[model samples]
Target chain A: MKAKIYIKYKEGILDPQGKTVHNALESMDIKDISCVTIGKYIEMDFDNISKESAELITEDSCKKLLANPNTESYTFEIVD
Target chain B: MKAKIYIKYKEGILDPQGKTVHNALESMDIKDISCVTIGKYIEMDFDNISKESAELITEDSCKKLLANPNTESYTFEIVD
Candidate 1:
């Protein structure tokens, strides 16, 4: 199985990195962008695990290590 | 318009961060993961630009700043 997880800061959390990129883009004349945000993308391949097991592992990983629940949220999808 | 961009390291490049996470997960007993990779996800909202313009800007940004073309590749989708 394969899983992809996206972890992003929750709404209202200040994202300094994202802000820096936004400014950089504007200075580069890539105009018309109203907003820009950045996050983490993780991909994992599992060794012949069932879909349920993959889901459990993915969720647990997100909660335990991949995401900071108080400041960030994560969503993941599993595929065989 | 809104755009979502994913930037990932090219094949054969070493991903130390991913490796560290893999080890951590193993120590935490979240076994059976064969591989783990990490990347960047960027979200941008545009101010009523045409799709073609959005595409051009996105590609330019990826080449200029958002991605290190020597080691990373990027893909993006734009929607209204």
Candidate 2:
């Protein structure tokens, strides 16, 4: 089985990198570009695991390894 | 309309944050967790834009504002 995890910064957090990119875009004459936020993606492939097992593994992964849970949020989908 | 953008680290890039999380997981007695990589998600909502126009806007937003296009890659989908 395979799972894809996406993690990103919280909406209200200050993202300096994103701000820099937004400024660069304005300098490049791109109009109406409001904002940008950055985060992470992880793809995991496991063998010999049932769907329920994968869900448990993924939940643990998110809590312990994948997301900070303080400043970031994560979502994942299992693939057949 | 709304667009969801996902950006992530390249496969080969070294993610120290991910590694740190992995190590923490190990210390917490979680096994079989091989590796972790992190990335970002950006959701944008725009008013008064056609789908084609949104595509163009998004492509330009990605190139100039949304993605670095060097160490990161991005994908965006338009929502009704």
Candidate 3:
């Protein structure tokens, strides 16, 4: 199975990298760009695990290590 | 319009961060995980631009600033 997880800072949090990206776009004459938020995309491959177990592990990873739930939100998808 | 860009290191490249995460997972007893790779997910919002223009700008951004074409590749999707 393969799993993908995306993690992003919560709204209203100050995202310095996003702000920098926005500014860079403006400098490049991309004035129509309004917002730029950067996040993490994690891809994982699993073997010898059932889909249900993969899902549980992913959820646990997100909560325990992949994201700081208080400030970051995460979503994941699993595929065979 | 909203655009999503995913940038990742090319295959065969060493991803230190990913390795660290793998080790962490192993330490936590998540041994079924075989491989892990981490990348950047960038989301941008645009106003007053046609879809074609948004696509062009996103491509340019990936080439010029968002990714190093030598070792990184990027893909994007735009939505109205």
Candidate 4:
């Protein structure tokens, strides 16, 4: 199975990077854009693992390293 | 409309961050993993634009700011 993970800052956390990009876009004349948020997208290939195992591994990895629990939230899905 | 952009290093380009994370996962004894890739996931909110305009804006933004065409490739979709 393959796993796709998305990690983003939790709501209420200030995202300076996002704000900077928003300003950059404005300066570039890319208007009508109200917000710009950036996050991490991770794709993992597993060696013939069951979906259940992949989910377990993905969750563990997210908690242990992929995301900072206090500030970031993550979601993952396992696919063929 | 909202634009969802996913940008990643081209297939031949080296992804040091992904490699480092893979190695870290290995050291943590998370096995059955063949490969890992890390990419940028950007979400942009546009102010009441038509679908056609959204597409054009998204494409332009990807080319002008969101992606480095020389070493990175991107795909985006306009979502409701």
Candidate 5:
């Protein structure tokens, strides 16, 4: 099974890196780009893992290492 | 319209951050975590852009700012 995990900063949190990028875009004249937030994407492939098992593994992975739960949230998709 | 843009390091490129995370996972004894690669996710909402125009804008954003074309590739989806 293949799984894709997306971890992102929660809304309302300040993101300095994203701010820098947003300013850079503004400087380049890209209009109306209200805001930008940078996050992480992780894709993993495993053998003999069912969709249910993948979700369990993914949840554990996110809590154990993939994200800082206090500041970030994560979602995952199990691909057949 | 809302658009979610996912930018990731191309396969075969080394990702030091991901490597560190992978090692951390290993240290924690999280088994079967073959490898990990980290990337970016950007979600934006606009008041008045058509899907076709949003795709064009997204392509331009990826090329000019959201991604480093030399090392990363990006994909986007328009969400209503």
Candidate 6:
């Protein structure tokens, strides 16, 4: 199975990377842009583990290091 | 509109970050995990531009900077 974690900056939080990307887009004359944000997408493959276990582990990873609790939020899914 | 660009390492590419995460998962006793891969997710907001133009700009951005043609692959979507 493969597990995917999606992490993104919390709403209302200032995102410098996103700002940079937005500015870059503007410079390219790709105007009309409003805001930009950046995030992380992580995929983990596993087998033989209970789905419950995978969920727990993914939750742990997201809460521990995969995201900064203060500024980032994450969600995950498991797939066969 | 909002554009999302998802960038991931090409298949068979070595990913130290994924390896590290895998090792960490193991250490946490969250075994059963086979492999891990990390990626970037970027969101760009825009207005007034035709979806066609937005698509072109997003493609150009991905080809130019959002992804490395050699080791990374990217896909994007525009949303309201």
RMSD of each: 1.1, 2.9, 1.2, 1.2, 1.6, 1.9
- Quality of candidate 2 docking, DockQ: 0.45
Number of the top candidate by DockQ? 1
Residues A16-41 of candidate 3 have per-residue lDDT tens digits of 99999889877887667888999998
In model 2 chain A, which range of ten residues has the least summed lDDT? A30-39
Assess every candidate by TM-score: 0.95, 0.74, 0.94, 0.94, 0.90, 0.88
**After best superposition, candidate 6 residue B76: deviation in angstroms?**
1.9
Show model 5 residue runs off by greater than 4 Å: none
Error of 2 at A15 (Å): 3.8
Model 1 segments beyond 4 Å from truth? none
Residue-by-residue lDDT tens digits, candidate 4, B14-74: 9999999999999999888898999988888989889899888889888998899999999
* Candidate 1 structure quality by residue, lDDT tens digits, A49-69: 799999999999999999999
Per-residue lDDT of model 3, residues B1-80, tens digit only: 99888888999999999999999998988778999999998998888899998998888888888889889888999988
Clashes of 2: 7
Question: For residues A1-80, what per-residue lDDT tens digits would candidate 6 score against the true structure?
Answer: 67888899999999999888777877876667677789998988777787888888788878877899998998888877
| Candidate 2 lDDT by residue in tens digits, A9-57 | 8879887876776677678876555565666677666667788787788
* Deviation from native of the Cα of residue B8 in model 6, angstroms: 0.8
How far residue B61's Cα lies from its native spot in candidate 2, in Å, is 3.1
Task: List where candidate 6 sits over 4 angstroms from the true fold.
Answer: none
Candidate numbers, best DockQ first, in rank order:
1, 4, 3, 6, 5, 2
Give the range where candidate 4 chain A is weakest over 10 consecutive residues by summed lDDT: A6-15
Tens digit of per-residue lDDT, candidate 6, span B1-80: 67878889999999999899888878877667788899998887777788888888788878876789999999889877
Which prediction has more favorable TM-score, 2 or 3? Answer: 3
Question: How big is the positional error of residue B2 in model 3, measured in Å on the Cα after superposition?
Answer: 0.8
Interface quality of candidate 5 as DockQ: 0.62
lDDT of 3 at B62: 85
Worst lDDT run of 10 residues, candidate 3 chain A, spans A25-34
In model 4, the runs with Cα more than 4 Å from the true position are none
lDDT of 5 by residue, A1-80 (tens): 77788888987788898788778877887656666778888887666767787788778889987889899999999887
Among these predictions, the greatest TM-score belongs to 1
Mind giving the per-residue lDDT tens digits that candidate 1 earns over B1-80? 88889888999999999999999999999999999999998988888889999998888888999999899988899978
